[model samples]
Target: MGVQVWTWILVGITFAIYFGIAIWARAGSTKDFYVAGGGVSPLANGLATAADWMSAASFISMAGIISFSGYDGSVYLMGWTGGYVLLALLLAPYLRKFGKFTVPDFIGDRYYSNTARTVAVICALIVSFTYVAGQMRGVGIVFSQFLQVDITLGVIIGMAVVLVFAFLGGMKGITYTQVAQYCVLIFAFMVPAIFISFQMTGSPIPQIGMGGKVEDGAYLLDKLDQLHTQLGFKAYTSGSKSTWDVFAITLALMVGTAGLPHVIVRFFTVPKVKDARKSAGLALLFIAILYTTAPAIAVFSRTNLIETVSNTAYKNMPQWFRNWENTGLIAWTDKNNDGKIQYVNGAALEGKTPMFLSERGEHGQRVISNSSTGPNELYVDRDIMVLANPEIAKLPDWVIALVAAGGLAAALSTAAGLLLVISTSVSHDLIKKQLRPDISDKAELKIARISIVVAIIVAGIFGIYPPGFVAAVVALAFGLAAASFFPAIILGIFDKRMNKEGAVAGMVVGTVLMLFYMVRFKTGLVGVLDPLPESEWWFGTSPEGFGTVAMLVNVVIAVVISRVTPAPPASVQDIVENIRIPSGAGQASTH
Candidate 1:
């Protein structure tokens, strides 16, 4: 069967399932809209949360990044999964006990200040918006290939589908829909990994196969490291990033993952505080299924790509190679014009670089040249690794179609969750709490639905005309969350004396500082300033690593400011103590 036919069939089936879930799980009240009636089973909530947490980046782009970054990529693995440990132990259960419908609601009530809540809402919007744009891009990439439409139209179609499900069902619908999506995406992700593992190492399990010896008796990592060095790249088993920077990036990602409002909101859907904890554990397990296999996939794909494509002539390349090259993501320049492609470290090559060209070959391949005449002759976008993996391995057409469906599932599930956060923050935290406290439940729910539509449109715009600094901004979203929300939420829980002034100041300062660092380094927002180099870094902290510094600043400032101010009132202190005790947990309260 043709790729389009298979894609349409599989994608159509998944869409039908999602739309059915949306109709069946439609919210009947504000409680249903916001927290799915707070009666979700722990097992089910875990699946839904997994779907929400594993965005397109996790399913599609992560392994690709890992493949090229080698050991340095461990930061993503440790940081993302490690954050779940903190969520399970530090945040989820206590937040569930607090029984608020959203993260901002908890901040408002906990600190006894609308200003604190407002700050939190702004942070939530920024984080969720930045993250969702990436997911939108993922959605567009899949649909653009599957439906044969331009990326802009693909994004619009994706937005329309998400609108129907989210606007109609709210959290009630999105939760159940995510459960279905989790199953689809995980299955889609694993099949290719298992196939590649068996093909390469004769073992069905990717994890064990990764370590198992192949035909030559050398372990897979050893082979990869050997090949990597031969090609002038860093050894695959060793890291290139500095230790302090890796630690800082990992720490920032961990805290940022915990601080994200969309993931935190999942706990609010469970029946009890205990269920929230149990659900976090299950979600981690579900996520780990993919996370553990990803490194294996990365090693396999990297080895295969290097062996197959490096030094091969363009005319003799495989169809999958040619197919991807047509997408403009995979490009090669005959820099030496020897008619053989050289894929090596560009920095290490000697000579002036060949000029880049807009011309195309008869095969429709881009006429690329060396960025400089280093050993480099090719540019492969890391984002294409997973999506191109099945084809790279010469897997069946149906499996490729399934991967397309999986990408959409990963992108759509997270997009819905983030949009929910955006809409709820606007309607529940900003409008209902501040502007119209006495608004009818019906009116507030209506506004929330409208907010979802508006948020989707705004998110789509960001995706379509993304900025040059989007990559940094996306990472900075987590940094911003880590720096701002993590400290405030933690201090609010553990310290009864944490006053509103301290919390507000910490959030504001942390968010602003992180933004300043990101905009200055990544964008022209600073206006023609010379690029900051590694030598100028504060204690070797890169912009990506600065979140940890900002987080510490928030903690220290909040602590110092709280000490100088009056303590929190007795009633608020009592509520804090009550939250620490897990018993008598109730459903999420709108009031």
Candidate 2:
């Protein structure tokens, strides 16, 4: 069968499976909708959480970023994976021990203030919506490219899929669906990577192939280092970033990962605190499988890309080149009319005379076009690397189809999880707790489904009109979560003296600071901080790394303000004490 036929077949099978699971696991009560009746096994919850956390950002964009950025991209790999350590050690077990249905519930009860809870609800909504918009956009991108549908229609289809499962089954349905998604996405990601690894290094293991010797008798890392240095770029294994920026970015991601409402809420599905801790460990193992393979894929794809295009004539380029160019991902312009493509570090031209582009090389520059007078320029979008990998590696058409399915699986699983959090926060925290205390469980469940539908519509609209690149939006979401939620939750758990006033003030200040910096640096709000000139960065840290500083500001402000204010009431302190001890896990009640 043709690739399109196989793609449709795979998609049809996936849809049928997900819908069947949704019907079989339909939630009948508010508790089931909110937390899967609070009886999920650790291993199952871990698999579900892995599926929910990976998202399109991990499966699609991460390897691409690493491919282009080289060693600098390691920060993302380390930061994202390392954050789980913090989550397992400091956050998950305590939150699970607290036995709350929502993150806001813990804040409200622990602080003994409804104001604190309301603030958390608002923060959760902001972070979840911002993050979900990117996931929805990813789903649309995958559908548009592989399914041959318009982006808007793709987004609507994706929304329908999420709503069918999430609205009917809630957490109960979403959990099992995510488990299946995890299997599909992992298999899809690994197959092409393993094939490419063997083709490049005669090793079937991707992680080892990353640093292994190439077929040409050169170490892979050494060759990458040589290529980077020749192109006036940094080495592939080391970085030139400032220590403070690294520290800050790492810290921000750690806190943000722990504070993500969707991720944290997954722990609530497990029956006990011990299960939560065990589930966290399992979740990390699942995530590590992709995390370890991703760097290998990055290195392999980068090497393949550079080697394939470096000296080849534009007319003789592979079909994959034209295919990606049609997607607007790779473009070529000839300057000296030599008909060959030239790829180099654009940043190397800064502060130095453009001898290559402005003049001719010793070998005489090759220009593929008569319209330009300089050397040829190559532009490759990072987003295309992973999606185009199978074609580049000459893998089977079925593998490409599987990748498309995997991309959708990653996006849909996370979208369902985020939607559940958004719905529960609305129906349980806002409606049941604040709006209508007398609301019945049936009424709450109905409202949860309605909220899921509404959330899907909002997310779909944003998906069609995504604000920026996928990774950039994801970083912003993490920054917001780190600034607003991490401080409150950490202080609430560890410090007995942290008060509602301190937590609220810290979150507001941190969130505002992060927004201001991101707008100024990333979105061009200020003329003084334009994209040109390497000196434009604040302390040489990119906007993506600014979240770390924001997180610190939050922690410091919260601590300082807490000292100035009265401590929490004795009852609140007792609740904190109870949460710290695991023995009373069964007795800890959700509001």
Candidate 3:
């Protein structure tokens, strides 16, 4: 069979497996829909959480970002993974001990304010919707590349699949399907990295292979550093960002990971607090498998890409290059009519000359005018690196097919998790708790399904018209989560004196300030506000990293408000104490 046929076959098989799990685990009640009846095993929950957390960003975009950004990309690696540590150590156990079906449930009951819960619902929707939009786009990109479908059509198909699983199975079905997804995605990610590592450095482990010597006996990191320095780019292993910016981005991601409502909700599915903690450890372990391999994949692919295109003619470019070019991700402009493509630093230092300088020196002047003449520029979309890796490395067609399926799995799993959070917040928190307390469970389930459909449509629209900065947009979502939800939840858990006034004030102020800053810098508002130079960033933190600052502001505001106002009642203090101890796990109060 041809590659396309095999790709479809693999995708079909994955859908069948997911659909089967959804049907087999079909949720029968509100409890099932909300938290999988609160009986999921630690291992299963861990796998499901891994699937939920990975998303399209992790599977498709992360390595690509790392590949282009080099050492600077480690911020993503450390930020995302480290955030999970915060979640496991500080948040998950306590939240699971509270034994609520949804995040808003914890917020509402803990704060003793329905308004607080509603605000949380709104925040969850915004964060999840923004994040899911990117996932849907990722699915579309994968489908357009592998299945030869139009991007819009791919998004629609992906949306349909997600609706079936998420709306039909709810949490119960999504959980089991996610476990399967975790398996497929991890295998797909590792197989190519392993192959490339062995081929380039004679090492089976890609992580070690990244720093290991190349066939020419030079260290890969050292060689990449040399290439980047020659090209007038920062060294591969060093960073160009200010220390404060790095710290802010890392802190934002870490808090955002801890604050993400969808990720936090996963712990509620497990049976006990201890199980939640164990699942956290397991989730990180599964995540680390891909996270560690990702850097290696980035380094390997970057090396392979530079080596292949550095001196090759456009006509000599590989099939994968041409294929990706058709996607408009890779473009070549032949400036001087030289058949050979020249890959060099577009800008070189003035006085400090290099062996290879582009037509333009450090200044905006052209230097080497296509001495040979070829494409002046090559633009390769970062998303293509991982999806096209197997083909680039000349791996088996089955491996390519597996990657397609894995990408879909990663996208769909995260979409399902996000949809569940949105739906539960709407049906359980907004509707049942506030709007219609007397509604039947069956009716609530219907409303949850309706919410899922609506959320899916909204997310699909975003996939079609993706924001200009996909990575930064996703980071912003994390930042918002960190700023608004993380502080509220952490305070609610750890601080007995925290009052509803403080929580509500913190969430509103933090969320609003973060949104304002994001809109001002990230969107068209920058033109109106007058753009701020990179050097003028607040506290030297980039807009992308401003979530940490916003979060700190939230904490400060919350503490001040709590101190000024009255503290939580003694009953609330007792409740906090009860949540801290695991011995009362079985009889834990839902409130």
lDDT of each: 0.87, 0.83, 0.85
Candidate RMSDs in order: 4.1, 5.4, 5.9
Stretches of candidate 2 off by over 4 Å are 335-337, 347-376, 524-534, 584-591
Instruction: Give the per-residue lDDT of model 3 (tens digit) for 1-591.
Output: 766888999999999999999899999999999899999999999999999999888988899889888878889999999999999999999999898888889999998889999999988988998788889889898889888888899999999999988987899999999999999999988988898899989999998899899878999999988887775667888888888888999999999999999999999999878899999999999999999999999888887888788757776787877676555455554454466655665521221111223343332223332233223344466777888888878888888888999999999999999989989999999999999999999999999999999989998998987764356667888999998999999999989999999999999999998887877676545336644566656777877799999999999999999999988888888889888766656796879
Candidate 2: give its CA RMSD in angstroms. Answer: 5.4
Top lDDT model: 1
The superposed Cα distance between candidate 3 and the true structure at residue 71, in angstroms, equals 0.9
Between candidates 1 and 2, the one scoring higher on lDDT is: 1
Better of 1 and 3 by TM-score: 1
Which candidate, 1 or 3, has the higher lDDT?
A: 1
Candidate 3, overall lDDT?
0.85
TM-score of each: 0.94, 0.91, 0.92
Off by over 4 Å in 1: 347-358, 362-365, 369-373, 467-473, 526-531, 582-591
> How many residue pairs of model 2 clash at the backbone?
3
Runs off by more than 4 Å, candidate 3: 346-376, 525-536, 584-591
